[model samples]
Target: MTAEFHVFTCLSDNIGVLMRDTTTGACASIDAPEEGPILAALEETGWQLTDILVTHKHLDHVAGVAPLKERFGARVVAPAREAEFVPQADLLVNEGDRVMVGTLASDVIFTPGHTAGHIVFHFDGAKALFAGDTLFALGCGRLLEGTPADMWHSLQKLAALPDDTLVFCGHEYTLSNARFALAADPDNQALKLRAAVVEGQRADGQLTIPSRLQDEKATNPFLRADRPELARSVKLDGRDPVAVFAALREWKNSF
Candidate 1:
């Protein structure tokens, strides 16, 4: 009984992932930015959604929860720490908690940086993670509710995953992020080449996301902020990992 997974992009720049058990037909929707796209995706796949796995409380992530719940009677599972934001969680989960959609089991990794209660769902066997606004393909989310240290730890956690892990982030900010990455890490030949590739993709109206963790490790500036080249470019005197992280984030806020 192999687990099946499908990713449907929603909103202007958001993703909604569908995970299912091929045998039991149980399915889970990872975040609902909008109803129309989610409904259409489910219909197209002929999936019966049994769960709504929310990553955070941001409207862009959970705005369609009510409608989806009303339509499919799906149980809402969210981080217990974010109960105030996700008040109606039917199942309150915490770090290391596991949720299932039939044979597809996802281990919850609490990553509170983009949001204080944010958590990314990692299906280790599947090599997939539903990282909503914490880590992007070539970038990381802005520090909205959490501090730089919080985001740093969260990113570190995600970075420790298998290099082949497919990172499904929240938005299509890759191309723009690559441009910034070049500015911050000019000596990175791989990042420069990636920027060119991403530019071509963007020019052709393509979406650059769901990037492999390995690619991100090489090209994502947020992840490479510790590199000597990036550290020097950011002009942080200390060269500490935390200091480098802070410089990269500050530069991104304006980028």
Candidate 2:
């Protein structure tokens, strides 16, 4: 009884995901970015949608929720803190809660900063993380509503996950993130190699997502803010990791 996933592009750069539990044939959509693509994917795979796990209240993420639920009679699971915005949710979950899609279970991790109530789903058994707009490939979400310290703490929680974990983020921002990573950590050999790979991926009309957590830990400037080399790269030697993270984020805002 293993878990299976289908990744597809939706509404410009957004990524849509469909997860299925092989034991029970229960399927779930990570977020409803758009109904047409999601429905199309379901039709193509012949997997019935049973649940919609939402990460936050953002429109792009929730826009297709109601329509999909109506189409498939799927249960909607959303963050309790943002329940007001996600009026279609059938279940509201908080941090440390467990969400089950048939036999597949996911741990809910409250990850604010991208939005006040953002949450990511970690399927420990599958080593898969569905991070919506919170953590990108080599970058992280903008501090739209939360502080630098909040984002830093949130990132630390994710960075603590096993090295083998696979991260499926909400968008295809890896190319731009790679460029920023090179500027932020030019001396990083791993980053240089990754940037080259990302370049080729995008140039060939490919997706560079589902990135390995180990690769991110090595090349992502956001996750490496605590490292002395990253601090020196930003000329913030001896500064607190949170401060270094803040400087890197601010630099990325304009990058």
Candidate 3:
């Protein structure tokens, strides 16, 4: 059976998502950004969180995990590479490992950029992906612990997924991402148009997330580093995609 996903916000901009398999009523909480929101969502939905999927050991992502685990006995799954930083990880997974959420199985994708052990959960069967900080709506995660090439390679892996994939990222920074995207790829009409929509959404107190891969492929400057328009906008026309990507990341850091 397909997994049902309930997405909500917690903390400042962190996005909290819960996946429940209707067939067996097994539920998974993608990340515990805060105990209040996670527990509230469970109570509101009346769904017990049976598993906790930690993308990385970032404080915002794991701070409330132990409480939720204690409260609901939810099994914790985290990257084996950085289990020391993650609390109470019952299952240590790496790239290509598959974890079952009741009857549904999600493929593990190792995307090291924001952190060395960051990973994403992709349920191809359900066309849903929990990207964490690796990939966002119109931007990719900031390269903190990893190099630009490492981040680029990781993003390339995600960009290759089916275009219909619904990417649930870790934060709500799409409005700012859209603005910077325009400067990075000024000639992109699609991006300009999307930025307008994003502005309106934020003004109305709406969430502009769970972006489709196809739209990102077309308008996301980071993902379109190989495209000539992006290279030209950065005045590095005909440059290698990796080089362009590196420059773009640095530019966005200050943007």
- TM-score against truth, every candidate: 0.95, 0.98, 0.98
Query: What's the lDDT for all of these models?
Result: 0.86, 0.94, 0.91
Give lDDT: candidate 3, residue 33.
Answer: 94
Off by over 4 Å in 2: none
Which wins on lDDT, candidate 1 or candidate 3? Answer: 3
Model 1 residue-pair collision total: 0
Collision pairs in model 1 = none
lDDT of 3 by residue, 22-75 (tens): 999999999889999988898999998899999998999999888988888899
Candidates 2 and 3 compared by lDDT, better number: 2
Could you give candidate 2's per-residue lDDT for residues 1-255 as a string of tens digits?
589999999999999999999999999999998999998999999999999999998888999999999988999999999999989999999999999999888999999999999999999998899999999999899999999999999999999999999999999999999999999999999999999999999999999989999999999999999999889988999999999999999999998
Quote the positional error of residue 156 for candidate 2 in Å: 0.5
Where's the lowest-lDDT run of ten residues in candidate 2? 1-10
Q: Cα deviation of 100 in candidate 2 (Å)?
A: 0.4
Indicate the worst ten consecutive residues by lDDT in candidate 1.
1-10
Q: For candidate 3, what is the lDDT?
A: 0.91
Comparing 1 and 2 on lDDT, the stronger one: 2
